[model samples]
Target: MLIATTFSSIASAADETVTGIELSYDSWDYNTSTSSLEVFIDDDAVIVSLLAATSSSSTKKDVSASATWKSSNTSYVKVDKGVLTAVGKGTATISATYGGYTQNIKVTSDYVYDSVQILKNGSNAAESYDVSLGAEQVFTLSGIKSGASNENITTNATWTSSSSSVATVDDGTVTLVGVGTTTITAKYKGKSDTVKLVVTSPYKSLALSPKTLLEIDMGDDDQTIQAIATTTSGSTETVTAKATWTTSSAAVATVEDGVVTPVATGQTKITATYLGVSSTIDVVVRTPYQSIKLSPAKEYQMMLNSPGLQITAEVQELSGNDENVTTQAEWTSSNLLVATVTNGLVTPKAVGTTKITASIKGISRSIDITVFPSVTELTIDKESIDTFPEKSETLPKVSGNTFGGDTADVSKIVKWTVADEKIATIKDGKWTADAVGKTVVTAELNGLKATFELNVHLTPVKLVPSTKELSVVIGKDLALPTITVVNQDGSEEDVSSKATWKASSDNAIVVNGKVKGLEASKVTLTATYLNKTTTVKAYVEEEIEKLVAEPSSLELYPGKSKSVKVTGYYVSGKKVVLSSKMNWTVSSSTLATVNGSTVKALAVGSGKLTGSYQGKTLEIPITVSPKLKSLTLSDKSLKLSPGASYSLKLQANYTTGNPVDVTTSAAWVTNKASVATVSNGKIIALSKGSATIKATFDGKTVSMRVTVK
Candidate 1:
């Protein structure tokens, strides 16, 4: 078998001068004197490499892509850039030349099969296979040879099916034609193999019904359980009679062919098994009802001609479980003139007393109810009032008038709500305005509603500043102006701390009426309160000549990061750090990435970091090196089977930040290339032996022991 075939790394030559060359496959040297190239027919394509040795070094280099390749007999074998493929069973000569040097190797291609076998799903050896209805199964034909490698001949073999009506075979691919058993045969060269195949439902699992816990009342009819067999094709069939049914306790329940009969008042488990799949359910048998009781055991008082209340009837079962039988029970009222009841719903018709009864399964329960007269009209003290934001006031007093000409306070009992919460809020008889808006406050009681219009007014006509002009030096704190909001109703309010402040330029910053000078320039400041804005002129006085960045240069390893600080020097000997106000960028994104003033090195290269402040730009040269603090392999040791390959990852940890993946860039070497060879961190096991793999990068070295068997 061939393993680890990746062609992305091929078709490339080194920049070194070639002096001599040799051909190899899987790190195994090919000899043209005595050994001949042996290849199996219809096997995986093998890659041959041309290793060149330069005059300046003793080590051999890969020059396969730069070499010219040919096969003497194209019918026997085909060579494409050192990749050899067997087309027919014959002998051929493979030759490669590079830099006036040529090498030739003899190749022999044939199917040396000692035995033929059938594989299921490309791997496991099987004597029989199953194909679901409306589905297909692909069988692999493996030609195993003694003292030689095995090859897959699925496409090269001739396929035949014993029953064409049940299943059809085409190149080891068995297609289901009907539901029956068929024999599949594969003929490759002079060897043949056969495997039994069944085309049917291909049952996957068994589901039993009913799925819930079976509850049977004493003296009730017998219940039947069902078993459903689901196939792999998502088709289901009833197999209750075909399944094996058993009961856990025969004293409580007896089950025969999915039919269960309760024998006593107890619980038992019922199980059904079909086609190697089984499902179970709990069976419960007991006396259903012991006694029934109404939800409200005492008398209930309600208002007359109001909304009705639903009374539930709960029954205590013999199994110690409660069941709500409100709809199932029969409900009635003792006095129809006072109240009426239907389906456990009781409604009061008059101001009198009545008894409500609910009966279920010959068990009865009763509750006494008293109805009171409802209110006629609801009234409040005041209709509406005005308020402002952040102001609270007490709500109006409410009274309910009854038919008997009596009145009572209903302020606390009434439900209050505001139409718009953005305007105000009323809770516990206290109203507080949140913003300047108009909304209605509604109070509801006894099916009567009372609404009042509330208008929150805070309209500001003009904004006035305490100061008209201001001046401050760079790196100094600027004095902010106090603002006052003048309302339209001839009223004024100071809003210095509650206004949105902004500056027209980067020379100064204003937050909540606090200002700080950033550069030597003049800017306009504005303060806004309730949509009324006022302006003020501010001057940031400073004589700045140039800008400078600390640590004129930067040197960091890959994956390392740091921040650059920018400062401005004034001609008056005043210096200030303006890192946040400076716009930063990098010359090459492939070398480093800049976020604000922070710079992170990405790869090994040289670039320039530029920062522009107040029209003055400064460049800081940056150098990224591949100097690693430590290097290690992901696996300390590895064990692999013959003809198997594994990719090893090398982590290069730097002095700062996280490690980087340098697997493909590191130099890989193996002590025994014949046993195991490594290319760009991928190790391929050629034969059963041991080898040591080493990786070197950035003056750091790490090794791993590999045992292939």
Candidate 2:
């Protein structure tokens, strides 16, 4: 067998230099030639070295060919190529010279009487040895009483095997060669010992299982291949996990340990090697296996009355495989109420969501489903449900008919939404009343919305009188208190109709939403709502003894304003400002106007500003004066030639106002048209003559003379 050989260390040596020569080996060196290189007979071989130039840190070099060797006492020791050999037991000196530099090595070969013994180690005794097959054995030999101290001699003990074909020994290490018998011996100084030995083979051939393999599809699970090794002694062992595995074509298949994975569509060989024996199997990786998928794998949606859609499943078959088997695929629905699938036809029903599944041959796929409602008609029997606070009741029924004429009772199925959950809530046709107030209750079914109002009547926790005081003109009625019904949760609601009202004195007044002014006497008004009562005070004013406009008199200019106040004197001698409460008007709107208590002057005229309440009326004397002093024409005279025209304008100069344009308001005329004609401040010339043009504004006139060109 061709054994692959592999070819470390500690040291104790001091370097010595002499003249220009350096001794490289510290184990054997000398100061001078007389004691230069020293070594023992049959000692571990050591090399004598000489270097002209070197450092201890330099890499050690064996330049035996470069140096000449010399030896003293050639019979006892010899030097050849710087290597000293002991031929007899004696002392000798060895030396080497290179490049004009020389170093010496002294040798001491001992001649001592010694016996040898055989052992597993401690060389010098064992020259040849045997080892059992399938194992490595170490042999040893020693010289008895050989040195001056009479110790075992181990150095320079040569080792060999009698039959190298059966066993081999290097130094003292022995390796078994075959299963056979042999003899081993150890010798030293004409003394020797022999031992009979035998070696056995522990391993033989390795075999792989599934000697022939079928083609495997790509993506197939990894497969394990078994390995078994047999010994020459007829014993077998499993080494699958320990055996090294390889694939001829890793692109087609790959093997790790004993597991094989098909990679691509090709053929490859798998080999398992154990104990130097290899076994192989063929592996073919074919295309992947066939599969199936639904057309809409993600999700599908359908609406009521929408055109029917066909659900399909396609089989992605392998080469030479069967065609699509959509017709044979089984169909199922997660919700029949939401949608239905029959013979691949998906018919949407009421609104909801569901999952549709398809199965064929052992493969299956599913689609997420959503069905929206299509309502043809929605109906609820009631507009509102009535319940007291903190009460419960069954909600009214609701029904929905789809466009497909399918009717469903949605009273319990519909989702209920409430504007105020504190007021009322509905769940599965059950209503829970929480507080007082009316809230809209909406029901949603089949995508259509329907609503039934919820009225949670306030349980009379307390009543609040919204009206505190009332002032009414004599013989005039006043609005009554708007009683607020408070619920148990400190909530208030206007429930005026929920309570009956009785006046303390019907002769004095009556209360409902209002109290009528029946008499001038004091009266008590009471309001009740939801069986809760609250009271308010009311006093009708006595008939007015006199009525007057405050400030007694007034004066204003045209197009000016004045704020007025009206006061009424009662029979009790009290005065009240009735300007806002009384109906206000002006005697002549053309002159002035009064809205509430404010008066506007329309022109330079006077009108009575009046205030009235409860059939009593009062008026104020007012006066308005014009602000203008005179009216004048812009041009005193307009001269024109016959066949020419001229225009004249009028202006009003005021006492307190800025000059105002009166041209548009002035009346224009010509006294003699033969000379010139004036119309609307424009003069047209006909014949040559003089004429007088008159402009009038607000009963005042200005004249101008004109001549035609």
Candidate 3:
């Protein structure tokens, strides 16, 4: 027989737990003295257990018993009695048997249970979290449990990074590093849970919109380009861009920083590149050509024989693009035989239409020019003289003619004819005149006839006398010659009325017609008619005569009152008059006294007496001798001195009827200072000696010395 209890020995336990059982204790205790068993189970399962007791008298009694489980199953189990016991002091087991089978269970009272739980604070169970790369994520762990109160439980949780480049986790917190997928593990007490953390890069995908080419103008640099970029992963990204420019023809076109320029007169292409992608652009860089234009752009006209004309041309426009410009321009004319051009200057050589053209940069323009015949006219004025003497009295008309034409040969012939044959005549446009009169004249030039009046004037004719030939003493009238004009019918005509007369010298003469002034002299006369002038000479002569004083005879006595008379003569047919007062003088004051034309002797001396009448005067000598006291005669009374001789000189006073004779005597002597001696009323001196002589007259003797040596 066996008794069964629902307990097992708690001393033995495996290192690892089995599927559904936990060991309550590692050791068990039993008291033999009280015949009781102590049971210890895991602390979580330490409640009562079902066991069956059986008494056994012998070692093998029937011990099939049934026991009811308390904390486990409600079913009863039969155990053999040998299964209910404790192997150690702190272990217990129960076994029970109902039929032939028995089962044993172990329970421990000294077992302790410890556990920990991890949870996110204030979060749902299955929610996901997000964080940027190089950023942080936090989580909290809670809900931990231990088997008993006041039990010492130790726990440590570590965070592990699945990918260091992507993310890392520590103490249930996670941090993102880069752009990739990673896991964050939370571990505690040899338990771990992993959370997936993906770290994405901040890079964006770039794309250029509108993949077509563009066109830009040459030399235009003011332009900008825009494009769009997108990220593959629904994230924001940053993109950078740049551009490069190129040209197809470097010489013709050049580009810098997406700008293109044209260098010559040609076309070229330019392209622009942006970022890592490239685009093509069509650009035309063209140079322009220049064209010339003529002002007056149509036609010009001038006379055939006109003065030189002027023409000009100018540059109008330049063709092509940016590089087209005119460098130089020139001008020329077509049909140089009719016209010529030099440096935009045009000249016509004949009467025709000529084209003048200007050229610049392979472009040209032309102008038409025409020349025509010229006309001239002639003007004539009445015939007249331009110059005439101021002294001319007769009227002299003047006239002229004017001629103008393209040729000087138009004035080949000119003819003139006068009407009055005697006054004036014309031949071959020349005129001649003989007298003072008005004459009609006609002039013909190249068969064109014209008429004029010519005036012919007579020159004044008169007798002209020198101023020296005119006399105030002569009471005579002077006459001047008269001038006459002949008429066309051969008749004499008085021309004095038409003449102008004037004295060539002033104060010389005055005249009226054929009459002369009181003072006579030559004069000039001038006459003019029909623009013609002439001159004539005139003369006047007169004579004058008068009585003048002269010495006919006169006598004076020495040392005595004696007088002499003077007389004047007047010629026939002469005008003469005597002055009221006569002029008289004596050569010696002591010898004579003159009153009027008479002289008186004062002393015994010889002197001359002079008298004047009108513009004439005369002088005469008078003899003055010494007074005789008595007469004495001598033998040499008639003797003469050597180298000296005396001739008989007889004197008679007409009023007194006295005759006197003088002679030199031989006894009379004459000194060298005395010239001769006298005897018988004459004395003589021999050999320049002096001698005494006597002159007897009226019983008075006069003695004088005559010396001769």
User: In the order shown, what is each candidate's alpha-carbon RMSD?
Assistant: 50.3, 23.1, 44.8
* TM-score of every candidate relative to the true structure: 0.28, 0.29, 0.17
Q: Mind giving the per-residue lDDT tens digits that candidate 2 earns over 1-709?
A: 1111110122223253222445555533333455444454554444665544344334444446767788788887877775766667677777776545556655675433455666764443344434445566766666566344544433445566677766777655666665566666665554555555666546677777876784676556888888988877879999998777888998888889888887667788998875446788898886543676777666765556566768777777666465555687788989999888876678888678888887654456788777655656667889867668778877777777766788756564567788898787766458888887899988775467888888777566888776555555556666665667777868877766665666677545564455677766566676765446777666677767777776776687787788888777887898878776666778887878876678878777666877766567777887987766788787777666778876677788876577888887888888897788878788898898888989887677789887655
Q: Give the whole-model CA lDDT for all candidates, comma-separated.
A: 0.80, 0.68, 0.44
Q: Which candidate comes out best when scored by TM-score?
A: 2
Worst 10 residues of 1 by lDDT: 1-10
- Residue-level lDDT tens digits of model 1 in 535-602: 98776767457787878899987878888888788778888786755667789989998876788999
The order by descending TM-score is: 2, 1, 3
Ranking by lDDT: 1, 2, 3
Model 3, total clashes: 126
What is the number of backbone collisions in each predicted candidate, taken in the order shown?
Answer: 0, 15, 126
